[model samples]
Target chain A: MIRDITIGQYLPGNSVLHRLDARMKAVLTFFFIIVIFLCKNFWSLGLMIAFTLLFTAISKVPLRMMLKSLKPIFVILIFTAVLNIFYTDGGRELFGFWKLSVTDKGLYTAGFMVIRIICLITGSSLLTYTTTPTLLTDAIERLLSPLKVFKIQVNTLAMMMTLALRFIPTLIEETDRIMNAQKARGADLESGGFIKRAKALIPILIPLFVSAFRRAYELAFAMECRCYRGGEGRTRMKQMKLKARDLGAAFLVAALFCGVFFLNYRFKALI
Target chain B: MNENIIEFNNVSFAYDSEIVNAPAVVKNVTLSIKRGSFVAVLGHNGSGKSTLAKLCNAILVPQTGKVTVNGMDTADNGLTFDIRRTVGMVFQNPDNQIVATVVEDDVAFGPENLGVEPKEIRRRVDEALKSVGMYDYRLFEPHKLSGGQKQRVAIAGITAMQTECIVLDEPTAMLDPRGRLEVMETVKRLNRELGITVVFITHFMNEATQADRVLVMDDGGIILDGTPKEVFSHKEIIIDAGLDLPAAAEFSDMLISDGFNLPDGILTAEECIEAIYAEAKKRGVC
Candidate 1:
């Protein structure tokens, strides 16, 4: 059941989007979020939505999995929509009650908020679904390399991120194994009151923590054995290069940004 | 470039530096591992065999005398990296050692750390993976691999570094029977084909039988060191070292004690079988 949580999971593929340099994808994803928020009307949002869907289709990410990524934020989406409807009061009142009212503007704003949230989740999900976790770490490290000028240990931080990402599934599997072993020995982990359940987890958590620390020590030793000395003077095996496709994608994003800016201005002038 | 890849000059080490009176984990160990030789270190748990492996790579610098690898003293701070690169160490836990998610990337890790060129690293990664018979699974996640395959990948990680020697501290300890065989065969092939010096630290007597030389440790010191035949011949010392003999040796000992003719220091099942067959033929039972 824990494995079904695929929000941050990468589905391996050879699609053009998947092959894009991770740094390019990361930068575009950031700018894409900005474009999503810069819109003031349905026209710009529609453009962004179309762009997301087209990219999603080209990337070959399963639409079902993409929707699953939005499941956790579904409640927040509704909350935002409800909050906008109840709080915002503006042009063309549609209905009214004591201390509460719904207006045409409120309805429009609520719908716009929902669409924005959906676009945000889907756009970011596309990034993860296309790029492997290691590539993502490399992309983040490369993008954040400028912080080195501020005396930041960018390489160390990036190496830590890469290790963390590499170990997530491993730790998850370990946790699952521990849970099963505890359950087989008559540990009541599933059936209990809240406090009782939390207490039952102690048996699993203790060993898990102990093993995790041991693993950390062993991994550190192994890393040292491989001559890893603080990542100084280290060269990367996989180098990220910006290719023609990345430039084309960047060009498309720039055009989208310009379109959103124009539409946001044009719509405001009319309003 | 030295014929002797690793040398320990009266080395002593301990885990807790605060305990000055505590016995060292590796006590006054003096040894040299020749280049392109397969040497097995045998001892039960807590016999300081693992500590010996660590000392070779400078992971745990000896507290007393000096340990050197490829003529670089492990005690020298700046030489630590070079020592490690010259003598790679693979631990028992496969999952803990593999740093990268992808097999090929993990294999490239050591070379990358050593500052190899990207293209050369790629070539080495592929070559290492192919050597370990995991080339087809290069892009696969490490966690998804079998225990044996994961250990192979770890070995590949060392191989790609172009290390002259690899110290496997019970690499097959966590593996199943098949996994153990797979890892053992891989290590042997690496030694025989590539002429990479191998220091296989294991408690398994059968494993020790395969090595060119076996060293038995007890109480943090080497008690016996010789070829498999010479080492297994002294049954009392092996038992005193907290180790059992290979099954063939024990069986041969039993047969000889039962007034049957059998060769001493039998180290393999096939050898035992052949001895039994010859005895039967001599008695006209065949």
Candidate 2:
């Protein structure tokens, strides 16, 4: 069960979207999210949804998997949908209850909120699905590198992130091994009360922490032995360049932004 | 002007000097490894063989005398990076030593740290991976590789740094027999083909037999030092160091004890077989 937590979630492919620069994907994803928020009417929201679907289609990740990725956020989606449905009373009532009414505006707002949330998740998931975690973090590091002028340790922060991501699978495997070892010793982790389960975790947690610390120390020694001196005068093996497709991707996002603005203006005039 | 790639001069170190008052993990040990020579250090668990390797790379600064790599003093803070770059290190645990998720990136780590140009790093990474025969696995995530493959990648990491020497602290201690053989083969190939100085610290008796010289440590000091033949000849000293003779050597000793005239320190299967054949011919038994 611990293995199901896919932190990187990258699916390797040879498509154009997968070939775009990670910074391009990351920037466009951020831009797309802000565009989602700017949608003020159904037409603009429809255009935003169209853009997201186009991205999802280009990514070629199975629709079912994309929806499955949203499972963790299902509760938030439902909660917001229900709140918007019951609250907001600015139009004709569709239903009535004790001091409660479902108006047309509330229904529209609820639909828009649900669509916006879904689009937001799918768009971001597309970015992660196409770009490996290392590349994604590298893009972030490069984007935030300007903070170095202010004496921020941006490189160290990025290194820590990359290391954290690199070790997640290893730690998960360790946790699974420790849990099984404890289980073999007849530790009752299942079929227990809440506090009992929490208490039962101590054996696993202690060993896990001990092993993690041991690994951290060994890793630090290894890093130091390789002449790691706090990000000074370091070069990278995989260099990221803004290729033609990346520029095209940026242009596509710009066009999407303009299309959303035009649709919002037209819809406001009609309303 | 010393021809020695690594020199240790009366060095000693302890983990916790203030509280425990225990003996140093590494004691007054003076040794020098010639350039392009394959040297193996053998000892039991607490014999400080690993500490000696760390001292060579300046990971553990000596408490008394100094360690010099390529004529730079390891104790000098300014030359720490230079020492590390001159003498690379591969630790026992392959998993902990790997710094990158991707195999190629991990291999590129050392060269990258050295501030090599990006183009040069790419070329060196490719060359190192190919040298270790892990070029095909350059794109694979490290967690997906086997123990042998990971160690090879770790070696590739050091190789990409273009270092003149590599110090492996029981690199095969945690590996399976097959993985051990794979790593040893890679180590030998690097030493032979690239003329890279190798300091292999291991407890495996058979592993020491392959080296040009073997140093046996007992209680943080060198107890035996010679060619494998010369060192394995002193069976009592090796045993006293809490190590066994190579299996072939033990077998040859068995034959000798049974009144056979086999020579001492027969280290390989073929040599043991030839010795038995020679004894049988001398007895006129075929």
Model 2, residue B254: C-alpha shift (Å): 0.9
Candidate 1 - chain A - TM: 0.92
User: Candidate 1: where is the Cα deviation over 4 Å?
Assistant: A1-7, A265-271, B282-286
Across residues A9-87, which tens digit of lDDT does each residue of candidate 1 receive? 8897999999999999999999999888888888888788889898999999998989999999999999999999888
For candidate 1, list the clashing residue pairs, or say none: none
Best by DockQ: 2
Identify the candidate with maximal lDDT: 2
lDDT of each: 0.90, 0.91
State the lDDT of candidate 1 residue by residue for B56-174, as single tens digits: 87778888999988788888888887778888888999999999777888999899988999999999999999888999999888878889999999999999999989999999999
Q: What is the DockQ score, from 0 to 1, of model 1?
A: 0.72
Candidate 2 wrong stretches, greater than 4 Å: A1-6, A269-271, B19-21, B278-286
DockQ of each: 0.72, 0.72
Error of 2 at B28 (Å): 1.9
